[model samples]
Structures are given as C-alpha cells and as structure tokens.
Target: MAEQQKEMSFLGHLEELRWHLVRSVAAIFILAITFFAFAEQVYDHFLLAHIKPDFITYQLFCDAFQLFGIDSAFCNVSFADKKLQSIKVTSQLMNSIWSSLILGLIVSFPYLLWEIWRFVAPGLTAHEIKKSKGFIFIASFLFFIGVLFSFYVIAPISIHFLYNYQITDAIENSFTLESHIGLVTNMLLGVSILFELPVLIYFLTKIGLITPEFLKKYRKHALVVVLILAAIITPPDVASQVIVAIPILILYEIGISVSRRVIKKQEKNANKS
Candidate 1:
C-alpha cells in the first residue's frame, strides 16, 4: 500500500508540473501573437531605434558633451538613409514572427518566474521559503535591468561602431534583417541571464557549494574573464568594453555579498532546527 501510494503521489506531482509548464507556454504564445499584430511599430520604434542618430542615448551623450564643452565627431552623425534591409521576401516575415516571440518572452518574464516559483514552492520548507521569499522579485528586477542596460547601453555602442564602420569611401555598410535582429536578441538575452549572478550565488551558498571567500580570491581572474566577455558582446573599443564590464563586475561583487548573507541565514536556520 505504501509503495502504491508513493507512486501515485509522484505521478500527481508530475501532472501538476505539466500544467504549470502548459500555462506558462500558453501565456508566452498569447503575448507573442499580440506583439506580432503590431510588428511594424515594434520594429521601427524599439528594435531599430538604436540605429537612429537621434535616439535618446546618442542624443543624451551629444547633449552631455556639448554641455561639458567637449567636441566629438560622433555626435554629428546623419541617421538618414541608414536602414536595415531584407534581401529575401521571406526574411522579413520570418524575423517579424521570431522577434515578436522574443519580445513576448521578455515582457512575460516576471509571470514566467512566478509560475516557476509556484511549482517549486511546494517542495521547500517554511524556513527555506522564508529565506528565498524575495528570490523571484529580485531575479526579475535584475533581469529587466539587464535588458534595459543592453538595450540602452550595449546595443547603442555596438550599433554606433558597426553602422558607421566602413572599409573605404567606396564601400557601404548595408545590414541584413537577420544580422541586425540576431545581434539585438543575442545581447538582450545574454546580458539578462548574466544579471542573475547574485541569485545564483545565493542558491549555491544555501546548498553549501560556494563561499564568498572563493569568489574574492578569484576576483582578479574574474575581472579578466568579464573583460573578455564584454569585448565579445560589445564593440571592440576600450570605452565600450569598460562600460559593459563595469556593471558585470559590480554584479559579481553583489553576488559575493549575497553569498555572505545566504551563509548567515543558513546558519540561523541550522540553529533554530
């Protein structure tokens, strides 16, 4: 009887998990369709905005330099006649569908996390639950911040360098729809996932897998790695590399702090038990 009951219980849990997965996916699809409906606006306003010289980031930098009595040739760029083109008729249609899906996933991230939390909460103890009470919110907040950072900071730097780059006066820079969308989505998702370092550290510390000391001891090595990653993601210029690397290193330090707090909480929970 005990064995049979355990099997039934296992199946029940699996069924519940399946439902959660279904609902989360359903939400993503629904949101994706909604975005696809307004695909033209999304492409023009959000996805391709960074390519425009008068986009807010470029404008803000131009204004800042002027206000501070600095002169930069980059500020006087002409955005006209610079547009991404699709070589094939199918490319535009395909990218529109995929880009909408990506945006849908990002916008629905908080809800997706909530669904994950709901599924995982049942397996945790009261102490564990309390300790991780803010996990979803903190994780979602960092993810969105990373998305914004990539969109506003990294994307602009990359677009500025790439769009303006030319081999010679005879050559022109014509970007394909695929290449443009690929770069944007890659940066957006990559940085957003990287920003979960603190949450990752907290969980690792809770499980007694990593410590603050370990992270601190390897800090220099981590800096090198961060710079390498920044170089890969952003423009090859030192200025762009430094801008992207700074926030990541800050997040690593924050991860160390989170690890320390997780240790303290684990010790307290041990004492209570």
Candidate 2:
C-alpha cells in the first residue's frame, strides 16, 4: 500500500509539473502576440535606438565630455559608414516573429520562474521551501538588471564601436540585420544568466558542490574569464570591456558571499537537526 501511494504521489507531481509548463507556455504566447502587434515601435524605439547619433547614452557622454573640457568621440554625431542589410525577403518577417518571442520570454520570465518554483516546492522540505521564499523576486530582479545593463551599456557601445571601425578604405562596414539582432540577443541572454551567479552559488553550496574557499582560491582565474567574457560581449575598446567587466566581477564576489552564507545556514540547520 505504501509503495502504491508513493507511485501515485510521483505521478501526481508529474501531472502538476505538466500543468505548470502549460500555463507558462500560454503566458509566453500571449506576451508574444502583444509584442508582435507592437513590433514596429519596439524595433524603432527600443532595438534600433542605439543606431541614432542622438541616443541617450551618446548625448549623456557628450555632455560629460564638454563639461570636463575633453574632445570625445561622443561629440561626433555620425557613424563612419555602416548599414544593416537583409539579404532575403523572408528575413524581416522571420526576425520580427523570433524577436517578439524573445521579448515575450523576457517579459514573462518572472511568472515562468514562479511556475517552476511552484512545481518544485512540493518536493522540498518545508524548511527548504521557506528558505527559498524569495527565489522568484531575487532571480527576476537580477535578470532584469542584467537585461538593462546589456541594452544600455553593452549594446550601444558595441554597436557604436563596430559600426565605426574601418579596417581599410576599400571595405564597407555593412552588417546583416540577422547579425546585429543575434549579437544583441546573445549578450542580453548571456548576461542575464551570468547575473544568476549568486543564486547558482547558493544552491551549489547548499548541495556541497561549492565553497567560499574554492571561490576565493580561483578568484584570479575567474577574473580573467570575466574579462574575456566582457570583451566578447561588449566592444573591443578598453573602456567598453572594463565597464562591462566591473559589474560581472562584482557579481562573482557576491556569489562568494552567498556561498558563505549558505554554508553557514546549512551548518546551523545540521546542528539543529
């Protein structure tokens, strides 16, 4: 009887998980439809805004340079010679659909995480569930922060630098629309995942796969990797790479702290047990 009950419980959990997944997918579809409806405005005002010379970042930097009595590239109002191209007739339509889906996923991330948590919560011990009560909020906050960083700091700088770079006078710097969108999407998604470092470390530490000591020991290596990652995600310029790297390094340090806290909490729980 006990074995039969256990099997039934397992099946029930799976059923619940299926429902959660269905709901999450529905949410995504709804948000995607909304994004698709406003695709033009999204592309013009949000995605392609960086291409304009009078973009907010450029204007702010230009003002700062003037105040400091410096001749900055931000003071210049034009890209050297670069244009986005679409080689196929279906490219624009395909990009619009895919980009709307990505936007939908991003906008619905919090609810998706909530559904995941709801599905997993029943399997966790009451104490464990309580400890993770703020999981959805923290994860969503970090993810959005990463998204903003990628959009405002990483994307604009990278676009400006790459669009302006000239290897030779003969070669034109025309990029494909697919290439530009791919770059932006990758950076945003990558950084958002990266920002979950602290949460990941917390869970790993809880399961004894990570430790504060281990993180500290490999800090230098991690810094190098972070710098390389920043360079990959941002522009080739030193300033751009450094700007992107700083927050990431800070996140790494925060992960270490989170690991320590998790270790301490586990130790306390064990003692109580």
Candidate 3:
C-alpha cells in the first residue's frame, strides 16, 4: 500500500509538471505567432538595424572621433555590396519561423520563469520559497539587460567589425541571412544566460557545491577565463572583447557576493533551528 501511495504521489507530481510545461509552451506559441504577424518590423528595426552605417553605435563613434579631431571609419556610410542570400528554397520560411520563436522566447521569458517557479515552489519548504521570492523578477531583469547589452553593444560592434574586415580585394562580403541571424541570436541568448551566473551561484551555494572562498581564491583565473570567453563571443577586436568582458567580470563578482550571502543565511537558519 505504501509503495502504491508513493507511485500515485509521483504520478501526481508528473501531472502537475505536465500542466506547467503545457502552459509555458502555450505562452511561447502565442507570442511566436504574434511576432510572426509583425515579422517585417522585427526584421527591419530590430534584427537588421545594426547593419546600417548610421546605427546609434556608429553615430556615437563618429561624434567621439570628431571631438578628438580625427578622421573616422564611421563616416563610411556604405556596406560593400552586402546582400543576404538564401540558398535553399525553404530557408527563408524556416528562418522566419525560428526567428519568431526566438523572439517569443525572449519576450515571454518572465512568464516562463514564473511558470517554472510555480511548478517548483510546491516542492520547496515555505522558508525556501520565501527566501527566493524575488528570483523570477531578478532573473528576468538580468536576462533582459543582458539581451539589450548584446543587441546594442556586442552585436553592433561585432557586425560592423566583421562586415568591414577584408583580407584581399578578391573576396566580397555578402552574408547569408541564416549566418547573420544566427550570430545575432546566439549572442543574445548566450549573454542572457551568462547573466544568470549569480542565480546559478546561489543555488550551488545552497546545495553546498560552491563557497565564497572558492570563488575568491580563483578570482584571477576567472578573470583570464572571462577575457577568453569574451574574446570568443565578441568580434576579434580589443574594444569589443573588453566591452563584453567587463559585464561578465562584474557578474562573477556579484556571484561571489551572492554565494557569501546564501552561506551566511543558511548558517543563521541552522543556528536558529
């Protein structure tokens, strides 16, 4: 009877999880359909906006150059014969569908996080759930901030640098639509997840896998790794790499602080218990 009760309980949890997942999927699909309905605006003003020479970043660079009384590449207003091509017949349709889904995922991130939290909250102690009351909000905020950072700073810089780079006069710089979208989407997703470092650290600390001392002791090594990661993710330029690395380093520091706080809280709670 006890074994049967355990099985039923497990089945009930699974049923609850299924509903949460179903709701999350429905939200994503709804948002994706909405994005698809306005795909042109999304493609123009959001995705391909950085390809223009007069993008906000370039304008800022132009202003900075003028302030220094120097000639600037920012004045170069034309991309060299850059047109996006789709080699396969279904490529455009597939790309559009995937892009819409990506946009949906981004837009619905907070709600998705909420659903996940709701699903998991029942299993957690009341105190634990209370302790993490702001998790969804903070995580969503960090994610959106990271996405903006990627879109405004990293994506534009990377696109401009790569589009302008030339090895020989023989090669032209016509990019495929898939390639361009892939780069933008990957950077957006990657940076947003990277910004979750503090939250990840909190959980790790709670589970006793990490401590403040471990993070502090390896801080220098972490810096080097962060720089390398930034170099890998951003354009092959010092400025771009530095811009990407700074936020990640800050996140690492924040993660260390979060770990320390979690440890302290756990210690206090233990003493009280």
Q: Pick by lDDT: which candidate is best?
A: 3
Q: Can you write out model 2's per-residue Cα lDDT over 68-153, one digit (the tens) per residue?
A: 89988977868535568999999999998998888889989999999989888877999879978899999999999999988887
- Whole-model lDDT values for every prediction: 0.87, 0.86, 0.88
Q: Tell me the tens digit of each residue's lDDT in model 1 across 1-273.
A: 999999999999999999999999998899999989999899889998887778888877788899989996558867587877889979988998999899889989999999998899999999878966787889999999999999998888777877877879999888888998988888898788878878888878877889999999999999999889887776667877788788999999999998988788778978999
Q: How many backbone clashes does candidate 2 have?
A: 0
Model 3, which residues run further than 4 Å from truth? none
lDDT of 2: 0.86
User: Comparing candidate 1 with candidate 2, which one achieves the higher TM-score?
Assistant: 1
Please identify which of the two predictions, 2 or 3, would achieve the higher TM-score against the true structure. Answer: 3
List model 3 lDDT by residue over 33-149, tens digit each. 998898899898988888877789888878889999999887675664778889999988899899999989988999999999998898899887997789999999999999999
Clashing residue pairs in candidate 1 (N, C-alpha, C atoms within 3 angstroms): none
Clashing pairs in 2: none
Candidate 2 deviant stretches above 4 angstroms: 1-3, 79-82, 235-238
Task: Give the local distance difference test score of model 1.
Answer: 0.87
Pairs that collide in candidate 3 are none
Better model by lDDT, 2 or 3? 3
TM-scores for all candidates? 0.93, 0.92, 0.93
> Candidates sorted by lDDT, descending order?
3, 1, 2
